[model samples]
Target: MTRSEQLFEEAAQYIPGGVNNPLRSFAGMGQPLRFIRRADESRVYDVDGHVYIDFVCSGGAALLGHNPPLVKKAVLEAVQNGLNYEACAEAELKLAKLIVQLVPSVQMVRMVSSVTEAVLSAVCAARSATGRKRLIRFAGCRHGGFDTAEGDPSGVSLLCGGGQDVLEAQYNDLSSVERLLEENKGQVAAVIIEPLAAHMGVIEPEPEFLQGLRRLCGQSGTILIFDETVTGFRLALGGAQEYYGVKPDMTIFGEILGAGLPAGALGGSRAIMEQLAPVGPVYQADACNGNPVAMAAGFAQLSSVLNQPLLYEKLAREGEALRAGLRELFPECTVGGVGSISSLLFTPGPVKHDRDAKRGDQGQFARYFSHMLQNGIFMMPSQFEPVFLSGAHTERDVEMFLEASAEFLA
Candidate 1:
């Protein structure tokens, strides 16, 4: 057996399912999980000394690609100063300023450690500001594995917690949202969505869908929350709000903004943001809140994004090349997503919503995933996740991926 296989076997003795996250288990793929040794640029090396072109990109964190010198230098320097002072640091203001400057709707910001905390805090602030109870989240948009009142809720079931009324709507369906608004009326505190549902294998919002949500939220006095954890700093320097030209009242950012570190943030207009923490009534706190090292890495990464010209264009071009290549190679399958993110669904065509995504051939996709891995291409184990490209991925990487994909489909 391989070292990865052995390690997973041993880890299962201690860690549940032999992995920290459920998705990492590689369960039902008919193969053991690969334990990564190291990654550089667009490639990851497994413990068994096998190298593969990486499309996961540390769950969409390494936008500049794995271990960029700029972010690494900043992180090392920050560590030299200290890790977490447990008190306010200058880096906090610097990072916050950069976020506020980029995202126009985010006039104020609060840093947190994970997307889970950021989403929970944002929802709390929304509830406090609106004096309402219910939050409406779309199907297939996962904020995180939130511990709901009932324990380990999945999908729309996450809404079942704290006696807080939660509602679910369909993606790309404006009438569904409007119907919920009519039914719930003034009780809806916020409407939270992914903008681009990367969690649902990269479902982009229809222009009218987002614009309609904004209008609906405005009319209903509901706070619109954009869970940009996957799209933030990835779609653009200003994120999906700038890319799509539809802003959310509150935005939750994660991972990519931290330049491959563990980090997340909640930001919004001052009127709504003032409702969180010591500034207002809603309470949220973490011991490592605003850790200096994380802020430093974030500041460096965002600075590069803001200063670098044509970065987004390069990423988008590469992403398009990948999608186009897949469509050409596998005409039988469906391919979609936005800039720097794409997915291949084992379906004939037209995968619009969660229900549509469920119609895909899971068995075919599992076979495809195994075939790609054998060809030295590392893709998401599950069909529901996106293949993330980074600025570090070159045209050569795209070409190699296309060649491997061609071999798989052949």
Candidate 2:
């Protein structure tokens, strides 16, 4: 057996599913997961020393690519000083300031350990500020693991564990949201959604749909939140909210915001954000919310994006090339989404909602995923997830990927 196989065997004995995250497992691909030793730029080296061009980009966290020199230097400097003080740091303040400047609607920002915590804190803050108990979330738009945003099997509530009042609305369907607001009138605290629904195969909200949502929230006094955890720096430095020109009452961010470090943030107007504890009464705290190392890395990363705006332009051009290549190679498949985030649905026609995405051919996707992996291209094993492009991906990288994809499709 290979070293990776042996490692997986040993890992299975200790770690549940032999991996920390579900996507890391090879269940979807019907093969053993190849353990990666390290990643640099656009490539990852597996345990067997085979290298693959990574399209997953650490699940959209490696915007500037794996361990960019600047981020590494910042992290090293932070570590030399100290890893974590569990106390406030200047890096946190700097990152928060940068975020506020980039996202104008965010007057104040609160740091957290993960996107899940940020979402929970935002939900609590909305509840406290509005004095309401219900929430409305779009179907298949994952806001971390928060129960309030989890989709329900029954197609009614947000999730089974949460109360039935957490209604589920279909993406791009303004009427669904309007109906939910009408049904739960005066009791809905927030309307939370992934501005670009990455979890459900990258469903972008229609202009009218997003405008209607903002107007409905305004009319009903519901707190509108854009969960930009995946789309924050990856889509644009200012996030999908800025890209779509649809501002929300609050924004939740993670992943790329910390330059691959474990960090999250909640940002909104000061009046709404002040509801959190120590300022008001919502009550949310974290021991490592602003870890010094993570904060430093985040600041460095955000500074790079702010200073070098051309990086996004490069990413956009590369993403367009990659998307075009995929369309040419697989004309039978459905390709959707925008910017650096895109997905290939093994079905025909445009997929505008989760229900449409559910019709994708899982078996075909599994085959494609396996072929890509075997041919030195790494992507998420699940059809529901989207692929990410990085500034590090070159024209050569795009060509090699297309060649590999062509062979796989054949």
Candidate 3:
């Protein structure tokens, strides 16, 4: 048996399902699950000593690629100073300042431990700012294991009473959102979405979808929140808000912010952000909020991205090349995504939202994943997730990926 399997078996005795996260379990995956030991620029090394070009990219966090020199150095330096402290650290100020300077919709930012927490806080702040109680989130846009409404497919189950005030809407369909806003009226506090809808196969917004949503929210006095977790630095230095030229009242961030560490933030105009505790009425606090080590790492990563000219241009070129190759190799499948994020769906034709994305054949995708794995390319086992192109990935890596995929089709 492989060492990874052995470790998983051992873990089942103590850890639930032999994995801390459900995705890592590789449940029902055609190939064996991987337990990684180490990672470096563009690749991950499994415990079995196998190396593969990593497309997971830490769920879109390694925008500058794995173990980035600047972020690593900053982390090590901060570690030397110590950890788990309470006092506000200087690193926090620097990172927050850098984020404010980069992201267009984020004039002020409050750090949190994870994207999940940031979502909760952002929703709460929205409600407080508008004095509304209901929230409307798009279907298929998973905002971390959130307790959402009925028939929600974003990984979290709707508990008996957990989502009484939450509402779901169709993505890329502004009419559905308009209806929700009209029906809820003053009760709707916020309309939160992954502007690019990367969670479900990376669907790009239709023309004026985001702009119309912003207009509707403004007309109804509701807060519009753009979840930039996946699209943050990977889309543009200004994120989706700047990329699309449509700004939201509040923005949620994750992934690249902490330099692939456990960190996230909620940011918005001062009027909305000041509603949080110590500044206004809404109360939100965490024992480990804005940890100094995380702050230092995030600052260094952002600084590198800022200093490096044409970084996005290079990443975009690689991403488009990969997408173009995939499209040619698999005429029967659908390839979608923008910027450095891409997706492969078994279904032919366009995928604009959750329903279209769900139409893709999962069983077929499992077979493709198994083929890629056998050929030394590691992608996310699930079809719904996106494939992030890392800055560390090179021409050779892209070539290898396309070759492996072509082999699968053959």
Candidate 4:
């Protein structure tokens, strides 16, 4: 048996399902999960002495790709100094300053531990700022740690609770959002959405949907929150708000902001963001918030990735080429996403929302996944997940992927 198999066997005895994250297990994906030794650039090396081009890119956090020189150096130096300070650090200030300079909507930002905390904090900030209780989230939008559901690969949760304060609406349907706003007029605190819906196979927003939402929020005095967990740095240096030309009152960021580390942030115009204590009443704190290592790493990565000339252009061009190739090769399958993020849905065309994404043939996808895994391609494994591209992924890597996919089709 392979060393990875042996490791999985040993781990199953202790670690639940032999994996830390549910997607790490091969339960539904139709093959044994390959154990990775290390990742570099655009490739991951498994314990079985195999190499696969890593398109997952740490859930799209490694836009600069895994362990880039600057990030590595920053992390190493920060580790040498110390781990956590539980207080302010220079690195935090640097990263926050850089983010504010880059993201126009986020005039002020607060550090947090994970995207889940960022979402919870953002919701709380919105409620506090507007003095309302209800939150409206879009179906199929992801909210990090709160993004949990079983079986249905095309998970379509609005990423909110069923309690009195939470309400849901369908994605890309501004009419639905309008209906909710009207029905709950003066009662809704915020309307949160994944500006790009990166969770459901990188579903781009429908034309004018965001503009309408912004207008409605402005009219209702409800805060508009954009869950930029996956889109923040990956989509564009300024994120989806800049990409789509719509500014949100608050932006929720994920680990991507920490350069693939366990850190996140919530931000908005200074007036709204100051609602969080010790500036205001809404409370949010964590021991690992603004961890020095993560902060240093994020500072280094973002300073480089967001400022590098034409890096985003390269990613966008390459992503389009790859998707175009997939479209030609897998004519029956649907290709979705924008900029550097792509998704191959084993379903029909125009996959806009969760309902459309759910039509994917998981059985066919399982067989396809098995074929791709055996042939040195490590995709996100689920139809709902986005296929992330990074600066490290060479043209040859894209060619190799398209060739392998063509072989599978043949």
Candidate 5:
């Protein structure tokens, strides 16, 4: 057996499912999970010494790619200074200021340790500010690990314990949102959505749909919250809000904003954000909130991103090349997404929402995944997740991916 297999066997004795995250188990692909030793640049090396081009890119957090020198230098420096102060620091202020300057709608920012905490705080603040109970979330839009809507029991009941009035609407369907608003009326506090639904295989938002959401939220006095955890810095320096020309009332960010570290933040107009404690009544706190190490890492990453004005352009060009290659090679499948994120669907064209994403042939995808892995390409095992490209991924890397994909198709 391989070293990775042996490690997995050892891990299974202690860790649940032999992995910390569900998707890591390779259950969706019906294959044994690879145990990674380390990752650098665009590649991850397994314990067995096998290397694969890592398309997952740490859930798109490593936009500059894994362990970029700038972020690494900042992290090491921060570690030498201290790990956590458990209090306000200059790093936090610097990161917050950068976020405020970059994101269009964020006026005041609150740091957190995870996207889940950020979402919870954002929703809580919205509820407090509006004096309302219900929150509206779209079906395909992921808001971290927590269950943001009723009837979605994917999250632990204990973590989702609260009897918060939550409502779910079909994604890209404005009429569904309007229907919910009509039903909930003044009781609706917020309408939260992933500006681009990466969790549902990179479903791009319909331009009219986002505009309609903004209009409806304004008309209904409900806060529109953009959960840009995956798309924030990766889509554009200003996030999906800037990319699409739609401004949300509040924005929750993670992934690239954290610079591959465990971090999240929620920001909005000061009038609504002040609802959080020490200013208003809504309460939220985390032991690792605004951790110095994470802040330093984020600042480094953000600074590098901002300094490179042509970064997004390169990503866009490469992503388009990859997408076009995939479509050209595999005419039977559908490809979707914008900028650096792309999803390969083993289904028909125009995959717009969760339901359409579900129609992809899972068995075919499982076989395709195995093939890609065999060819030294590491992709997300599930059909539901999108593949990510990073600044570190060269044009050659894209060609390699396309070549491997072509081989698999042949």
Candidate 6:
């Protein structure tokens, strides 16, 4: 057996599912996970020393690609000082300031260790502020693994297991949300959504739909929270809020903010954010909230994106090229979404809801994913997850991917 196979066997003995995350098990592709040894700009090296062009991009965290020199240097410097102080650090303050500046709606921010924590904290704060129990989340718009946000809330009978009172609405369908709000009536604390549903294969909100949501939240006194974990730095330096021109009352950020380190954040208007402990009643705290190394790496990454605005333009161009290539390679495939965040649905056009996405050819997608991996182009194993492209991906890489995809389609 190979070294990675041996490692997987040992890992299975200790770790449940032999993977840190459920999706990393490669169950969607019907293969064992490729244990990666190292990564550099736009590429990952497996334990067997095989290199592959990375489209996962650490699940959309490595926007500037893996181990960029500046982030690496910042992390190194932070390590020399300390890993975690267990107390507030200047890096946290700096990151907060940068986030506020970039996202005008975020007047105050609180740091956390992961997007899951950030989502939970944000919802808690929303509940505290609004004094409500219900939350409305759109179908397929995954915020995180929060109990309240898990499963199909629309009573579709495809539940993934979690808590209760999470009412579901259809994407781009304002009436679905309206019905939930009407049903809950003054009992809904918040409506959390991913403006671009990357988890459900990259379906973006129509302008009318987004505006309607904002209006509905205002009418109902419910907090509007945007989970920009994947689309934050990757879509634009300002994130999906900027791209869509629709701001949320609170925003949950992750990955790109951490510069490949473990970090997440909840930010919003000062009035709402101050509701957390040390200021108000809703208590939320973490021992390693602001790990110095993570903060340093995050600061370096955000600063790089801020300084080089053209990086976003380049990413857009690459995304367009990729989309075009995919269309040429698979004429029957449905492709859409904005900026570098895009997806190819193995179905007919007009995939606006989870039901639409459910009808996709999963068997064909499995073949496509396996073929792409075998050809040294790595994408997310699940058809539900959107493929990510980084600034590190070159035209040559795009061409290579297209070539491989053409073969797979053929």
Model number with the top lDDT: 5
Once all C-alphas are superposed, what RMSD does model 4 give against the true structure? 2.0
lDDT of each: 0.86, 0.84, 0.85, 0.86, 0.87, 0.83
Give me the overall lDDT of model 4. Answer: 0.86
Q: TM-score for model 4? A: 0.96
Question: Tens digit of lDDT per residue, candidate 2, span 1-410?
Answer: 99988999999999998988765778868767899999999999998999999988978888888988899999999999987887888988988999999987799999999887888788889988998988888888887653333333222233222666567788889999999999998999999988888886877787678888999999999999999988887777778888888999999998677788899999999999999889989888888988888889988888887788688888888778888998998888777768788888888767889888899899998888888888898988887888888877888987888898899867
lDDT of 1 at 44: 98
- The segments of candidate 3 whose C-alpha lies over 4 angstroms from its true place after superposition are 147-164
What TM-score do all the candidates reach, one by one? 0.96, 0.96, 0.96, 0.96, 0.96, 0.95
For all candidates, what are the clash counts? Answer: 0, 0, 0, 0, 0, 0
How high is the lDDT of residue 325 in model 3?
A: 96
Candidate 1: worst-modelled 10 consecutive residues by lDDT: 151-160
Candidate 5: TM-score? 0.96
Residue 139 displacement (Å), model 6: 1.3
Which lDDT tens digits does candidate 5 get at residues 1-410?
88877888999999998888766768767667898889999999998889999999998899999999999999999999899998888999999999999997999999999888888888889988998878787786777674434544223222323454767789999999999999888989899988888876778888699999999999999999998888898889999999999999999998566787899999999999999988899888888999999999999999999899999999999999999998898787888888999988888877778888888899998998999999999988887788999999999999999999888778
Model 5: ten consecutive residues of lowest lDDT:
153-162
Off by over 4 Å in 5: 147-164
Which regions of candidate 2 are displaced past 4 Å? 146-161
Candidate 4, 220-273: lDDT as tens digits? 999999988888977788899999999999998888877898989999999999
Off by over 4 Å in 6: 146-164
